[model samples]
Target: MKRIAVLGMPNTGKSTFFNRFTGATASVGNWAGMTVDLMMATLKIGEVTADVIDLPGIYDLRGFSEDEMVVQRFLESTPLHLIIIILNTVQIDRQLSLALQIKRLQIPAILLLNMADEAPKFGVKVNAEKIAQHLEMPVISMSAKYGNQYGKGYDAAIDAIAQTLHQQEHPICVRNISDCAIDDRQLATELDAILQDAVHISTQHSNTLTTRLDRFLLHPILGLPLFFAAMYLMFQVVYTLGTPLQAFLSFGLDWIKVAALEPVFTPFPSFLKGFLIGGLYDGIGTVVAFIPVILLFFFCMAIVEDSGYLARSAFLMDAFMERLGLDGRSFVMSLMGFGCNVPAIMGTRVMRSPGLRMLSMLVIPFSLCSARLNVFIFMTTALFTPQVAPGVLFSLYLFSFAAALVTALLFKGQFPNHDPLVLELPPYRFPTIKQIFVRAWVEVKHFLRWSNQFIIAGVVIIWLLNHLPMDVPPASKQTLSGMIGQAVQPLLQPLGINSQLAIALIFGFVAKEVVLGGLAVIYGASNDAGLGGAIAHQIDWVQAYSFMLFTLLYIPCLSTIAVLKRESKSAKFATLAVVWSIALAWITSFLFYQGARLLGF
Candidate 1:
């Protein structure tokens, strides 16, 4: 099959165009390095089928950013039939520079003026045919988000492109950069001539809404407060709305267990029945019940992202972040870390400087991800009253920021970086209902896909460790997990973590999403209520808080560590991520628990 690459600068709707044409659910986010790596999908246009590769967004071919290097390496090494170079129409003046650079490669290419619908609103008009005549290539003006369904405008565009492809005889040949080099002044002169001949602009109504909104949203004094208020409201909605949904889901799963599965297993042996229902059903089901909460959180996050406020949040935090030897982009990665640390770690590829990316990897794992949030909600509901539960949950988030801040400061000396933050503030647009729902659903599916195996395997292992040696009481000190937890209890005692909880922490190393399931298995609880009751009976509120703190700061999951190792390309760096975090976790929790006890809490 012929290969085509979709390439562009950030926020140019390149990925959206790729998704609409190829039907791949590549993550659509409004930030730099969102693509991070190449995403491949198969597409059929007219009578031809081809492989579509979505390359990471980059500003210039010669730029030194990780994403730029990725694009450069791919273009130089891979033979291709065509390159679809997308440019944001509103920013075409500068964006054309990238196209000019690519043209020097002397490869077959198409130029897409993406976000065309928004261009007129910004007082911009482009003559695509005229540009095509000038550049000797096909130029298409399109809003990638529209005509999403099959056999629509986007599909027709692809059909036309395919027809063009059939006219060519051979795969594209790679060209050396040194041979294509042109003087900067000559390139600028050529770009100016093209803009003068093929583009028109009116200044009156350009970006009016964006400028007006930025005044208030990016204000020095009010911007930070507004950002915080928005986040606080987001979490409040996630919890207040998610709690009932979680309870209903828990109830439904329990009903399925007792009403459906219990009868089917009745004829089986007693031990087999107990193993399936208790070890498998209850443990995994408890984690599954938290799905609604996770979905709601992502739903809210999707809105923040699609509405174009995510970039603004990064802008507002940039000044403060710089004081800590980081910048706004790093702050944005930390925010993405709140959703999941593995992808956020991968996102550090957006940074141009290697040291900044390394520093970000070191700090982003400290984010209070939704997986850890599941543990917090479970414990907070069980230990704190409804009136104060949200406060307890919010405190964990604050702790996350504090932890990231300290990590950045302590490690800044090790990884020195001096890159300035450069970010685009896209015009605010109201996201469609379909966009929000699809984004949330995709993320939910992602969480399920990534976590299911870990959750299931961890649950089974914990169950076996607790239930083996049938002569001893289940979860008793005589069992495997019990003896292991006991062996580690002395070390954890200072932080008020007990043997059973210690076992949960050990398994949590596999994945934070498994921690709740591990606890369900360890405590022999059949449901959320039972698990809550069992935990409450075993530990006081103070101990529970200490455990939460430790869980918040400790080592990242196995997936995160692997990504860290791969991204940093160093085993030592990944090992440091593990050791440094656990040390920080121990010191912080010990201080908090001991200090609270001294203050008579």
Candidate 2:
């Protein structure tokens, strides 16, 4: 199969195009490096089958960020059959520098003018045929988010590649230079000529809603408040408005237990019934109960992203970021970390400075990702009533931001100097309803795919741990996990997390959700009603609060650690993040416990 690599600067809709062509929802965002790692998919254009690889979004090849290095290595080793350089029509001048470098390789390529629809609205027009004549290659104008108008253009590029692969001479070269050396000024002049011929200004409008909103959203005084309010509403909706949906799902699960399982298992022994219904069903059911909240959270994020608010959020955070020895552009990755940290860490390549990039990667783990939020809400609402749950949940998010800020400050003191933040502010437009639904469904599907395998395995593991005994009664403080918990209890005693909870926290290092899984095993096995009922009967509100605090601040899951190791390129940094996070978690949990006790809570 022919190999075609899709290259572009960040936020140019490369991922959206990849998703459209491959039918793969590889996390499309309004920010750069969303596809941090290389993504491959097969696209069949009539008689030709081609392999399309999506490379990391980069600004210039001259820089040496991790994502840029990935692209560099691919260029050096792989014999790319064709290169599709996607350009945002609004930012054509800036994006063409990379195109100039790609052309120097003497490889067949096509200039894909993505987001063509937005160009006209931004008072810019590009003549595709004129651009093709100037560049001496095909130039296709396309809106990848909407249609297949450029299908023929993509085919033409492939045919050009096939025809030129073995040719003795190529059309592209540093023109009028026999020495085979190109100068920066000459490259700029050539680019300006191309833009002059291909690009035209139609008309410009003033006082757009985007500009008026930015006046407040980007203002130093009002920006932070608006940001907090926006996030507050997002969390509140997930918890408050999603409650009925969550409860309805839980009610249905309960009905299945009573109406379907009860009658069929009437003759079974009580232990067997408890094993299947209470241990198995209750353990998995609790985690599943939060699906509605998860979906709602993704839906809300999609709206914010689609509405083009995230870019403005990044712009607002840039100034504050400079104080921390990193650029504000890092906030884009940190914000994306809310949905998933893997891509967010990868997105750090957009920072341009290696020092700032590493610093951003270090703190990304501190972001309260959606996965951890699941554990947070489940434990918080179960321990405290729903009326006070939003406040408690909000506090956890605040704590996470605080942790990130403190870490950034500490890192800043150590490093001392870094690059200033430079970012592009794209013109905002109202996102289509169809686009929002598509993005939401894609995220929901991604969540289900990951949760189904790992969480199911987690449920079964907890069942074994809870069921297996070492000559100790189920309710005895001398049971297997209890003994293990006691052995480590002293270390966490200062933090007010008891032996059992500490043991659960240790298991959580493997995966944050496993803390709840561990709790299910310990509490579910002891009581017939399951983990929720057992916790309600045994643990007081203060201990529950301590548990939530520890869960929020403790070590991230193994997957996040692996991504950190890869992004930071130093085992020491990754280990430091893990150790410091745990220590911080212990300190915070301890303070909350003692303070709550002193306040007579």
* lDDT, each prediction: 0.85, 0.73
Best by TM-score: 1
Residue lDDT tens for model 1, 1-601: 8878788998887867786677655543322333244567776766777777888889888758888877876777677888899899988987998888888887888998877878878889899899888788888887776653422446546765787778765787565565678568978988998999999887675787888899999999999999888898888888899888999999999899889999999999977887898888988899889999999999999889878899999999998888888999998889998889988998888898888999999999999988898999999988999778888888888899999999999989899889998888889987667667767777788788888969989998989998778788788889888899899998899999999999999999999988898888887632345788989988888999999999999999998998899899999999999999999999999998999999998
Candidate 2: misplaced stretches above 4 Å? 25-36, 148-183, 202-207, 257-281, 451-453
Task: Give the per-residue lDDT of model 2 (tens digit) for 124-196.
Answer: 7778888778777777777766654534544454455445443413223222222334458888998889877
Clashing pairs in 1: none
List TM-scores for all candidates, in order.
0.94, 0.88
> Least lDDT summed over 10 consecutive residues: which range in candidate 2?
168-177
- The TM-score between candidate 1 and the true structure equals 0.94
Candidate 1's C-alpha lDDT?
0.85
